[model samples]
Target: MNIQKLAFVILLFISFTICSFPSTSYACKCVEPKSPTKELRESTAVFSGKVIDQLEKGRTQFVLFEVKETWKGLNESQAIVETVNSSSSCGYEFEDGKEYIVYTNETDGHLEVSLCSRTHLLSAASEDLDKLGKGEEPSEQVTLDLSDEDEPPVWMMLSLLVVGFGLAVFYGIKRVKKKVNK
Candidate 1:
């Protein structure tokens, strides 16, 4: 009887473990960005640009950039790059009017960027800048003020709250059941 009870408890534990934690289907996994030389060699394009605007289309966000300088692959004065909207999906959040040193891959003739890329804010890309040396400047400079950005969307906050509540309920029931069993 004791052995049977032990086995039943072990099965219950396993069931709870499996049911309480679900795999995150939307998470992104990426390898670390390589050194500047390796990054330049591997990437299709590398440039500095100021984000002019962002357009959301389905699961992706498109950032329109006014190209300032190019190190490889492109010579256009304007470019559009696509990234997923969710940060968990390795998406890059480009602030409007902010300058960035973007590293990109050419996929189906589209420029793609992610958090895993060596792309970063102009203020934070000193290493890439040092390696790139001098580059041809754009003919015109553009800037915009976007200080009135909105806070986190309501759906995101509500989703987090729901998850938290679910976890709390799960643990609370487990604790009450343990006390009852004792």
Candidate 2:
């Protein structure tokens, strides 16, 4: 119940609260089910093909494509059309032997795409976050280069020196007062 003990307990409580705050996470970074195949999940490639086969592989449904339009950065160059049971929020429907465009972007090496969108079809125009990884350079150019010898911006160094001098003066006065008290 002493003041020092109460202050220590309060400090400990504050430290614990600050340390326990929730951390941020990216879902795409996690590993996915084996059956779905990493290629089918995070590929940024696009190709046109007919859905020739569809089936369930383990917990995941897959669809095969017979590639017609070839492009760089997709799962593969080509495959005979096939369909497997799959679901997505991007509004793509699969039917046997139907010719359509297949767009895939893999997250954590898992495939995802906005099916049937104009942007998806135009591979060059893809704006998916997966395609453009985090911390991308802004398209606009703005440069503020500081020279190697550039002193800390004058104002910053001045303020810091002022604070240091103030602390020194405070301690000096305290020492003088203690000596006089003695």
Candidate 3:
């Protein structure tokens, strides 16, 4: 190869490598968090609840809470709160069975929380709770018995029974036919 052509190829290779390895950075950063009073004023919902369940769908998480107290938007015994699924995306790490004082905002008609918010585990939020004072019970509280309402619907149970009976009858007929043939 000619010296000029070789130098041009080397430069092109270097340029391509630089472009291919362009550095990308990501992190969850929050400014100085607001005080409890300011957070209370700014938050769309302020409540204390236990994390009953969490469902992660792609980059989003749906957290079910058995709400214990309400200071703002929450009015039901149970609430579903949405959040980013990852901590790198600033999502809160909620533990199943643990309580929390959650400060949330309304996004796209749903409640969302993040590490950037003043939300914290109830064990770590004593100061905020004291500052906020006593919270009220949810206005529309109702307990659902998993033993009853969450059982398979009647149609589903009946379908299972019918399928079981049909399988039993088919096996019985097959056994009788084999015996007669013998």
Candidate 4:
């Protein structure tokens, strides 16, 4: 019957879709990291700081740091550095309350860190610290919060509204169908 052929076609399409699009993960491909001296020269900000707070939104992570020492670029006591949300996305994972010597580059107007950067936990950066030599305290005090950094994307807000509207319409249709069947 025509219905059997239609069912077969639908099944074939589903199978093809599933087989064609296997689950995939992004893998970060980075060139070998440079030396601390070379990396410091390439950076927009180089400082040792403790992570105070972090906020993840979509694919971006905003990290707030309390700056302890400034070797280059940073003049403020507080700085916010942005990174990708995943290691697969080349993001460096910064744990809360942990001190780190961070190297960041200016990317698209934001100071961004990556797994490829010459950044490390404070405890692990002794050799780099010795090579880096003297550091000065941050001169200016500035406060930055994760909330002040990002607002939800307009497309995300619109997509949510559309999904909510669709669900309400589907519920109304189901109720109408049930009443008609009664």
Candidate 5:
């Protein structure tokens, strides 16, 4: 109920809220543009595959998968790739039994690539020139809405402020009442 105690409580609340917010950037679920080019360069490397499993390392999501067995271009090349899911903004939903092309590169560290929703690359669809209709639309890049990623939400800070002020007011009133009673 003392002023000193109230001030200390407010300070502690502020420090806790700052620590709770996210600091690390999240990886998007979508594939990067240079994935295809990376696939072309290496003769024998882990290019792509379906995500068989996933594990979380701190804030980063680690996607694990086997090599593409029925890949069309590479003549049956296969290798497992691990891509760090950095930001939840770009997080992907992995489907088992689906085929994908993986690309690996060394950036900051040894990093792997994941490109999804590429049914054409995977030999699942039939190849027919005349039978197939020519009205299919081209696929667009998948991008996450990262507008709120950097800043903490406004209401979050406001609520913290309200709670801190309320505590301070309650303590101030209690102190005044104790002095008057004495």
Candidate 6:
């Protein structure tokens, strides 16, 4: 009847609204990479490091690296690099407590890296190691000092806010429809 038709129309509208949200994931497009030596020459900082921590803010993931050795551009034993979250966006994913040979280029005063760069996990970077030879040792050992936290992460807070808002809207619509029927 009319009630069934109205329900179908509401469902279709809700489906369309959900489908219109912007997608964060994307396909990565990159040109053929240059030689290792060329990549090194073009990079502003080349080093091996362990990822101590990572924080995501907006579209960028901030990685805290404890530098072990330096081939170029880094003077501090600790550095922060910015990368995207998805490889499809050319972002390089660095796992916590894992060592990697990172090649970074300076972009607007921050170190940036992508999968298209010469960066790789230490165990898989033998070819790049052979090309780099022995790099300079870090002047001082760096350590992470993370404090214990009891609060939930930012994403969790945002998700809760969204769910609360959606429930409020759903109930409001249902109340309005009930009032109209009565």
Residue range 38-115, candidate 2, lDDT tens digits? 333444664555566654443234555555553435434334222223333233456666765455655556554443
**1 against 4, candidate with superior lDDT:** 4
Q: Per-residue error at 44 for model 1, in Å?
A: 0.8
Q: Identify the runs in model 6 with alpha carbons over 4 angstroms from their true place.
A: 1-25, 140-182
Q: Candidate 1 — which residues are off by over 4 angstroms?
A: 1-24, 138-182
- Clash number by candidate, in order: 0, 22, 0, 0, 12, 0
For candidate 1, write residues 1-182 as lDDT tens digits: 24456557657876887799896558878886699878889899899988998987657788989898988887778888889898898999999999999999988988999889899999998999999887776554545332334777768997897698568656766776687689
Estimate every model's Cα lDDT from 0 to 1: 0.82, 0.46, 0.83, 0.87, 0.46, 0.84
Indicate which candidate wins on lDDT: 4
lDDT of 2 at 14: 59
TM-score of each: 0.62, 0.33, 0.64, 0.72, 0.39, 0.65
Model with the higher TM-score, candidate 2 or 3:
3
lDDT at residue 22 of model 1 (Cα atoms): 92
Q: Quote the lDDT for 141 in model 4.
A: 89
Q: Over the stretch 1-182, how does candidate 5's per-residue lDDT look in tens digits?
A: 55677678768987897899867654446554433333444413433455565655433455555443322223332333334454345333445566544434444543444333222233443332122223222122222221223556668998898898788777787876798689
**Between candidates 2 and 5, the TM-score winner:** 5
lDDT of 5 at 92: 39
Q: Determine the backbone clash count of candidate 1.
A: 0
Shift in Å, residue 133, candidate 3 = 0.4
Arrange candidates by TM-score, highest first: which order? 4, 6, 3, 1, 5, 2
RMSD of 4: 6.0
Q: Per-residue alpha-carbon lDDT of model 4 for 1-182, expressed as tens digits?
A: 24455457656865886699796567898999898899989899999999999988768899999999989998999999999989898999999999999999998889999999988899999987998997999999898878754577869997897698567656766676677678
